[model samples]
Target: MKPKTPRISAVDLFCGVGGLTHGLVRSGVDVRAGIDLDPSCRYPYEANNSAVFVERDVNEVTPAEIKSYVGGRKGYSLLAGCAPCQPFSTYSQSGRSKKRGLDWQLVSKFGELVSQVQPDLVTMENVPQLQDHEVFEQFLGNLHGYSVSASVVECIKIGVPQSRKRLVVIASKLGALEIEAVGKKGNSVRTVRQEIADLPPIAAGEKHADDPLHAASSLSEVNMKRIRASKPGGTWRDWDPELLAACHRKTTGATYPSVYGRMEWDAPAPTITTQCFGYGNGRFGHPEQDRAISLREAAMLQTFPRDYKFLADDETVTFSRLGRLIGNAVPVRLGEVIGEILVEHVRKAEKGTLRPISEELSGRLF
Candidate 1:
């Protein structure tokens, strides 16, 4: 008989649009429930990930509930948590942050749950800046006996189409664990053309019936005029003298030229952010196309599948809502890489014999 398929189950905390959940499922892990307080996520989380969305706060969640949701058994029960990182994100320090609240305590809340549930595996992904946080240091210290591993790895090296770095950690009660990150090959990262080059042409705010999520958000009048003048890989500086934004003319705004720009057809995209649907956000404009990258393109740059559904049939395509979902997701591709490492960790867990790399993965390194 074919060797029994690996039995792994996962519970996703702060799961936005089920990107990671969907990836784990595709990799043969049985993803149970995607826990998040956002009720809006119910549609896409369940629609694409095939996992139930538990619309409850992660901090408020109890170990009994986690055990039940993960289906307590001999199989590996993976707890994946990506607490809201706006507080620790570089963007928070880059400018004045408009976001704050109890949600910032969630990373610690996750550590508390990990102490209680002691799942077979643990995974957390967030912006690379989080590695510098005192809370991150304390969280890693809390894993006393378990084999743990974490790194501030780049997403591009792992096949993500965008240039994004994330802090990924994996821990296990089993023995030691290790996950080797894919090294970046000569700067030729996957390009914008490789991602969505062949799709039929689409205008701003247009939707393609062939792909449910292949729709771009509409541009405002000013942005429309700007895009008309912009070239692929070109910046807002390319705009005609009359079309410059008042902010761009300001001395401070001149420092960031990547804003309000178009991606190059042969180049990788800038990081996809919550505002990626907006023409003025980052370099989200489609290469050769006169519009900001669509919700679908954003998701694709984040390494979600081409046909991944972002909404249920009854759900309306609201830019604010869908953009938030796609922007906030733990790129499924990242999760799959984590899953493969965790699966290997579990396989060696019984003997408590962690691969050397696993040991290196267990220690902390900035």
Candidate 2:
């Protein structure tokens, strides 16, 4: 008898714009459905992978719904849950009042779904800060019978073009299983200027009507003037004496200089933020162009393929939403690395040669 081929199946939770879903699909996994609360995700999620997207909050998702999507499919059932991690980010830790502390409950809530679905495999991608949360530890403890692995990983080491760090966890219910070590860093890191320099130039706070995704956000006249005066890798100090904000002149202002600078064309872009399209936000200004990175450029730095379509309409989408979607995503390249890791594990399992990580990363990204 011929040996069986692995039938891949996955369900993405908190699927913001389907970045993970797209990567899994690229690696030959059949993504059953993407579950999230935003109705806006439905179009892109469905359009890109043809996977149905549930516009329901994860708190309300039931096992029956998951079962219906799986439908007795005889393949690996991967429940990849990437709960929102803004509450655990370092940015949240320093300012904005700790009143919005990490919501530790989401992990346990996700655990409830895992207990119900009892998938062959489970994975989660989140901010590195989450690794220290008690709630995160509890979520790992809940996986009693499975081999669990969690690590604070550098996304660039995994081939993501940007510098983003995430905590990744992989667990298997069938038996002890762990993700393989990431290989040594790839040849040359992809830089911010290299990725988006080819696009047609657009001015600050302007939109490119041709390709909706290529549109640059319109800056306020004041901010636009600031961007024009901004130097690559230089901050507010570069501004003319009169142009300097009152905040910058204050005693507490020196520390915020990374906020309003342009990216260096030869280096990787600054980590994308929810406000990346704004020139005054996070060194997001273009190197030579007097504008922040465009929507397409932001997504590209997230490692989404250039042609990855986010919409099916001619109507324009706002930069705020675009920034949120791109910034929140696990780089699709990083997702592919996870998918490839899963693929290798599956392959090894078939050959009876699989091995588990020994207490996660000890040194290096590998």
Candidate 3:
């Protein structure tokens, strides 16, 4: 009889709302657990993914604890971390020197754990700006024993219905590493209309009675008037001068035209930020509706499944809390691509026909 293929298992650090876990599972990796500092994540992370949620800060995680969670599994073990990227984000760059502190240190901690535990595989995703930081360089330097490949991926090219950019790194102690791209532009790019056009519409400041999470934040009277005048792909520049905010009236703010704009139905959405439910944040206004995208719509754009449960039936949907969880999640489709990359690498290694790192790293392997 032929021997069985050994299972690959993973532990997700800073796993917000189980986005990475969900995608990895869909790609056939057994995600054993998730670790995060937020107590709020426990419910959705565990409920949706069927994985244990350890409510602890990544800085406080010990290598021994990680080993125990893997339960002495004999196959490849994976460690994935999507460290908070706000410290390295473009919005924070202007004040980074003053704000640089513990969060920046977390990446170094991830490096330290990898050096100590030497998991079979390690993967991470963060803002593309992180590639330019010294900390990222140090993390790459620390992976001397592994084959590593890192790239700035356009999320839209990976089946996500948003034009978000992220830096994805895949490292393996086993063999050569490569992450294949997913959706291709012009041919397979998903659009806002494709993802959420079928959902029942709700008016500004209203919730869908059937799906509580499909609720939009209440808009102020002035903001309702502002959205009424807004056009898809159009900016506040098109609005009546009287409706423009005092900030937009200034030359400096005029340069920020994407704010308070509506997303085009056929195009991908702007990046979903932690405050996406507010009409004033980014191009969050609905293409046709007079309110910002609902919490469910924002999650779907992040590549979460349409029926993914985030809250209990009795719980009131809190826009601020859910927005942070959805905005901060690693897009599930991106995670699935990462999983497929690792799985293919493992299969090639087992066959004793692994490709050379230099050749594989030169071009798009996907």
lDDT of each: 0.78, 0.76, 0.85
**What lDDT tens digits, residue by residue, belong to model 3 across residues 1-366?**
743334788899999899998998887788999999999898889888968999998889999998887748878999997988878776545666666667778888888888877888999888888888899998888788788878788878778889888898888887666444332223378999999999999998899988888999998998999999999999998988889999997889968998888999999999888889988988999999889999999999988898888998777888989999998999998888788777767877787777665445544423
- TM-score of every model versus the real structure: 0.90, 0.90, 0.93
In candidate 1, stretches whose alpha carbon ends up further than 4 angstroms from where it belongs are 1-4, 90-101, 179-188, 350-366
Q: Taking the tens digit of each residue's C-alpha lDDT, what string does model 2 give over 39-149? A: 877777787777998999787888888888875887778888688876766654554344334345566778888877888778888888777778777787767666676
Clashes of each: 4, 3, 0
- Pairwise TM-score winner, candidates 1 and 3: 3
Residue 362 of candidate 1: its Cα lDDT? 31
Reference-based lDDT, residue 240, model 3 = 88
Pairs with steric clashes in candidate 1: 148-362, 149-361, 177-358, 178-358
lDDT (Cα, 0-100) at 11 in candidate 1: 91
RMSD in angstroms, candidate 1? 3.1
Candidate 2 least-lDDT 10 residues: 357-366
lDDT of 1 by residue, 1-366 (tens): 643546888898898788888777766788888899988888778777667889998878999999997755757888887888877654445432555345447888888888888887788887777777788887787676667767887777767788888888877777655443233122246888898887778899898887757788888888888988888888888878899988899999988898888888887788888888888878888887888888888888888887777777776678888888888888887787777666655666555566543345435422
The reply for model 3, stretches above 4 Å from the true place, is 1-6, 92-99, 178-187, 356-366
